[model samples]
Target chain A: MRVTFPHMGTMSFAMQAILENLRLEVVPPPPITNRTLMLGAKYSPECVCLPFKVNIGNFIEAIELGADTVVMGGGIGPCRFGYYAELQQEILHDLGMRVNMIVLEPPQGANGGLWSSISKLSVGQSLWHVAAASYFAWHLCKGLDGVLQSLDLMRARETVPGSCDRIWNAAQKSIGQARTYRALRMAEKEIRQELSTLSLHLHKRPLRIGLVGEIYMLLEPKVNLHLAERLGYLGVEVHRSMSVSDWVARHLVPNPRARMHTRKVHEAARPYLRGFVGGHGLETIGESVLFAEGGIDGIIQVLPLTCMPEIVAQSLLPSISQRYGVPIITLVLDEHAGEAGLQTRLEAFVDMVGARKVHRGGGVSCAK
Target chain B: MPSKIFLGLDVGSVSTKVVAIDALGHVLARSYLPTQGQPIVAIQSALREIARALPPGVPVAGVATTGSGRVMASALVGADVVKNEITAHATATLRVLPSVRTIIEIGGQDSKIILLNHGVVTDFAMNTVCAAGTGSFLDRQAHRLGVPITELGELALKAASPTRIAGRCAVFAESDMIHKQQTGHSLSDIVAGLCEALVRNYLSNVAKGKTIAGPVSFQGGVAANVGILKAFESALALPIIVPEHYDVMGALGVAYLAQPTAGQTRFRGFGVVAADCQVKGEDCDGCGNRCEVVGFRIDGRVQAYWGDRCGKYSHVNYLSVGT
Candidate 1:
């Protein structure tokens, strides 16, 4: 059975297998774009951010393409993503789209319930088999991500631009053809060996940029202009504060009793807490402040236009900046964005961060 | 050391408020006034009022600004700490109630319900896209119904068999209220129905899945409507406690955040009150986004700017300005 999925950040393969293992057809959603934005705008409230519009468009498109099932992940927190499934469901229903949805709660919340998920998965297969399949899928995806990242580093160093793309395309083709993890592992080695043979220059000039803003934008490279890639291409190692794993960690293990700092973060954010505090923008502020105190080189606050929560954080950031003496660039994105404009600002921000490093005598605090 | 005075200003779309506190965080004086379109003029007016009420020769220490128009005014006044309404609101709630579990703030154009678990905001939601469940909606409807906004609470109290109105949006709700009136529904009942619909819309829209526990307080301009208060109580199956400064809670929250003392003064000098302030937005042709870059200038000098796709504006230019 043919299957499709939305181009989720770092979750393309795992979702494929999860659905396939469940004996369901996988239909991939279309990539985010202006057309998608228009569709969401046409259907959604004009007040929602661009990402919400994009996702709704993705779901709508996928559903129209005969994709009957959808999977989304988020926790009940400051980010609007937590309410996305609910709202998207409503939108889809209003649009007369019939589809099944899987809303995965962060596994690391106060009540970590992995067993229940396993039970749900085991409905279509044996518990051992389902668990094995999930593990295999998870590892395969991680393995692909690790290899892709390394290849990317090599590709960026190549004197020739498209030459690296050639190798990457070849490697991706090989990995996609692999049916088993063993096969995938073998393909990874071959791809790495070939990538190493290409004239490659690798240096350790990592830009410890503290990314603060919307969760989806941070993770979904397509939406954030593939910022991590762009930074890496500029010979900078990117350190993103968000990941699906971290999302689960924060959601299930929210304010763990064992960690004093976790408790502190919860308390520090309590006063500003509201249902759907509407954005994870403050996560960026908290991280930026943390990064600053820890001596990170620079902070990037990325968010969508008209985003209320990030706007709140933006208003609060100056104090955090003043407190830590860290230089931060807060970027507000919207549909009218152009690559040339983005690249210029990114180049300027990077140059500024680099110059500031020299000014600070290269003292970047790399503490978590 | 010279005595220090701290100031906090909250410039909302509806009103401008300022509070002066001595070094020990004791409020020395406070003033509030309608913003009336020109925030710069309103702020100066507020400052003049505060200055008139304040004792003479009180050296200023530090100043803070909060609210939607805060970024503009904070830069104008060189505020030391420019914060959001949420943080400011939390600060005020904690200072007063200390153990407030929830805060129901219904402002002029928007409404929010913040839920706290042990002084931490665990869950919160805001309604900004529509004015259906906000104080402004009530005001407009009151004007349309030929009832004074101030007497809305009493009018609602008299609404027997409250008329049912679908308050999902202000326009629809108003039309529905009119339709119900045409059907010969009692005005008091209709008013009460409107109140219920507003409360219900707020709950479903903003407070969904949020367990607003007891010790909850209602602040902001709309809290002044007793009909809405009773509606909230009836809807939540619990009573809502209205704060003393209900009408000026946003400003009050900033006061709590300012927490000024005798020596910390970040005021750009009251001299700025008279500075020619021009705030406007321009559509950036830099990208397809065409972001409306809001530029805040004083005396032709760009003090702060924001609303750009990249950090093209907020950065570089805001060296002296807070975010």
Candidate 2:
């Protein structure tokens, strides 16, 4: 059976690896562009978040590519994202695109869980084979995240402005072509080594900014206007509060380290936000507090326009800013979020952070 | 004649502003012109006006561009820095009143509020996908009322008791204004009501959740409206400081920013007033995406291409390396 799924930053790479390993033909969606957004927006519920529209667009493209079945992740949260699978199924049916939708839900009573969804893709394959493939997918995610971390660091310090970006583009292509876990590892290693060789402006002390927001807005660079790279180019080091690896570890794999990390974050968020208000809303507050405690220069929370969960988080941000003594900028993006407008806000925020740092004798406490 | 001067261009959707400043931040010359749906022509005209008024021997040390069409203007003028309208407005306000803590800027097509702490922008909120509380709305209403936009403020001030008008969306506001008129509310009262409605919209939408304090400065094209100014004063009960060149503050701010940046002047000279700039868009069918790429031409030579999703054709100056 030909399988397909929506793209979320680099998560598609890992997903592709898993499906390919299952001996299932995977039809990846076309690269996201304005056309994709337009198509998605035209037919989508007018008030649904940007990610939902983009996902529909991806599915439409994938289905056109002969994908008979779609793989989607299920959620358990106050956020509307948890209900997206059911809604998308209905919408697809309404659009006359009848295809099997395999939703991987949280393990619970009478629910076969994520593995059951994978088992369908495995078909005649043994459980051991599926387990091996899952192992490879996990490693691939970890490796890709590690490479990304290094790329973020290098982007800030690169002597040549576009060198890291050029290398990164090549590396992404190479990694995408890697068919095996060993090949993925090799590609990752080669990219990391290549990144290390690029000259860095060692004397430069970059501002550290934490990015916290809705997962899709943070993960999809197109959605956020490549905010991380834009910040990197402006000589700021960006640390995302959410990543695919974090999601994998916390939800899919659920290792002890990931569980502890989640607990710690939950503790950090307890004072400002007690529980998940849905779709990383609590985590956004938690990460802001944590980043402020870690002496991050500033925090930026990006959310799609009309995002309900983020609206809740956005309201609480002012108090969080006052309590933590950290400057935070909330950017709400829609189709009309002009590039000039976004850039201006970022530049002004950076200027304020820098001026504040200088005013505070260039000490880390300025961010506090 | 000054040894060094900086040029700042604020290219907005409805208008273009040009400002020339000396090293000490003294405005040497300034020009405001309607963009009229042709940014290139408007920019050239504004620059030509400023150039004509400038002293012959003065040299522009650097150039900066701002506003909605900043990138296009920057490419046209070879700008040293391209800034957003928020920064430009804040910078200009701070230059005039260092103690100013808040800025209420209603421009031609957009409205924004910038909150400042110790002369640094702490927070800001801007109107999104709405033009209910901006200059363009007022301009359109003025046209519909058969009155010149320049007389709108004075007309609003003459009102004894302003009528109530909904200030939610442009469509709603227009319909509400017509209803007020049909109900026999005086023209001045309706105009004043419109101003009050715009201010209300600004407060509820653009400046929502913002802790507005004293020493507030109102600037932008709409700041020239005494009606809007009075509405702001009554709404907040705070003394508002309007700079001398309130309408051209964005241009002034960008000029100030460009002054300190170390660079050779990229101001392609005032001769560009006559240079023909054209943009041509064509669909690139290299892939399934079929990106509509636009090429910017200056003096009949293609200078840059943009709008391609992938940099395969456009070669985007900014990098999108990571997924």
Candidate 3:
């Protein structure tokens, strides 16, 4: 009865057990690199989305390791996730893999139930087995997330070479062993505490920037070019709207986002948005407006070019900039690169942001 | 002058991620999470994580964001540099493996192929219209098979004779797989066929007319699968290399980008968790493209702007048009 999760891209939060029961076994896939991506692309259909290559690659790798059962959710709606299970299963079969592929739809949906159903299957079975496994998985995810959070803080201020990597490796090891909820909680707390003692001092003059983009690229340092750490070295506090825990708390759950702010989501979205409305871009638009209100200095948008939702936003982003009078720079990506050229562009953009901030006052400020 | 740091952020339909690095392209810290429908929540969470995860005392000097949410993330983080996923992914790849000629990234919702020249991206292709071959597809398939997604690769490897199946779309693929099973094709064969079909599908879809050079890397969240790895090795007629921390490379790339930017960063301080917000979109009657316009507001301010064909609604900066 080995349970598994598909590659979540950079959404580490899914590693958590989520529900009160059913412990999860966190599978550690080989880290993503140029080679890894190539392997995925090699076998995956050229027309397929990028995630297919990576996930199929991961599935192949895991199968070779002698695992039997694979698990995943059956999603629905505009985004392609709803039907992912079928295609991937077919691909696995075509690749000659033999194992049970379980598609878990939301508890209440067109597809059969999953999480709650898994919970229901717990009836008369060993609750301890479910609880223990779920606990272990949940703790590991929590511990890892907690540790990663602190590591990001340190990276923001780190000036010396190898410091960020050193802390990250240590933190990874510390959280990997997290067993129980309490243990995870302790380990995370300790990791953060230990990280607080870096030699680099916070400069009050750090620039404040807002980060928004596609989910996977936003969080995966390997994918997003390590922008936050670079900003930290420059004495700036990086602000990004995406986070790990926030996912479990916000979108994953079956409900509309709580309207905590007075600014209603502009009625501009009349009807197409009944319910969750798919991607986070819609939500990010509102969040960017909020950042403007919060007095964040400027904005940077990062996303895959073929991405429709983001592209749609990209088409309309000028309005956001004009409305808020904020500086915005955009970068589209696929895989190939000219690092030097990109660095030059980034340098120029930062200079512009700094210049604008200076013009605003000694430091940009938003009146409370 | 003291060394400067860099920041990279990737926001996708499913998740929003952030990363930070130093001048020499070393990773500092990274965060991964589901987008939860609100980019603000994702940004706030990423920032707070940065506040806690980065080297305790160093202050960020510059920031850049990549991904669908880059502009909004840039705004939230006060980014100094804002770039797209392609540039960010390409930049970060070069930073790590200086001579990578080809890159293939497949995440939860989409897939892309990038060709690089001495670390510079020359051409690339992406698939956003299809869910037929993405991580979410694997997630869904794994669920149907009643196996954990982590074991998909292992299970795939166990096939004696991989099954040949159609994979043009999920529905078609699934029905075909079931039909093959009904015809008594060995499970192993069925799996193999399915794999081949997916490869075929990818070739015709995302990789059409794209030349793939060697020194290739298979990255993104899905690179962990061994079954797919074998398929790739066979297709490319070359060995594929998967990097450690492959799942977070985009973040790493953007984080690396943040370091070399000039002057100071514009990233906001952490601890900003946007209050839960409800956002929506409307069909803007403002011209053709009948763009179903969308916008977001937090605490009563329109922060995010999207939905336009001719950049009419996209005007973030005052265009000097007709000036």
Best by lDDT: 2
| TM-score (chain A only) for the predictions, listed in order | 0.77, 0.95, 0.79
Which should have the higher TM-score, number 1 or number 2? 2
TM-score of 2: 0.92
Model 2 stretches astray by more than 4 angstroms: A108-110, A362-368, B1-3, B182-184, B261-263, B280-295, B302-323
Q: Could you tell me which 10 consecutive residues in candidate 3 chain A have the lowest summed lDDT?
A: A265-274
lDDT of 1 by residue, B231-254 (tens): 989888765788776666666666
The alpha-carbon lDDT assigned to residue A175 of candidate 3 equals 59
Q: Each model's C-alpha lDDT?
A: 0.68, 0.83, 0.61
Q: How would you order the candidates by TM-score, starting with the best?
A: 2, 1, 3
The best candidate in terms of DockQ: 2
Tens-digit lDDT track of model 2 for B1-323: 67788999999999999999988889999999999999999999998899899999777789999998987898788788888787888788887778889989889888888887766677777776567778888999999999899999999999999999999988998999999899899999999999999999999988877889989999989988999999999999999999899999999999988987745776788888888899889989765446578788898987666766445544444333111
As a whole number from 0 to 100, the lDDT of residue A265 in candidate 3 is 40
- Please, what is the TM-score per model? 0.54, 0.92, 0.48
RMSD of each: 14.5, 3.6, 23.2
Which lDDT tens digits does candidate 1 get at residues A1-368?
33445555656656676666666667777656556767877888777777877778888877877877667654555666678777887888877777655566666443544556445434657777776666666665655566556544454465443355456557546764455777878987887787777775555455566677777777676678767656655555456665643543454344464245444454544444422355575565566666676777777778877777788777676566556656566666765565444554455456445645654564531100
**Which candidate model has the greater DockQ, 1 or 2?**
2
Angstrom error at residue B274, model 1: 2.0
Model 1 chain A: which ten-residue window has the lowest total lDDT?
A359-368
TM-score value, chain A, candidate 2: 0.95
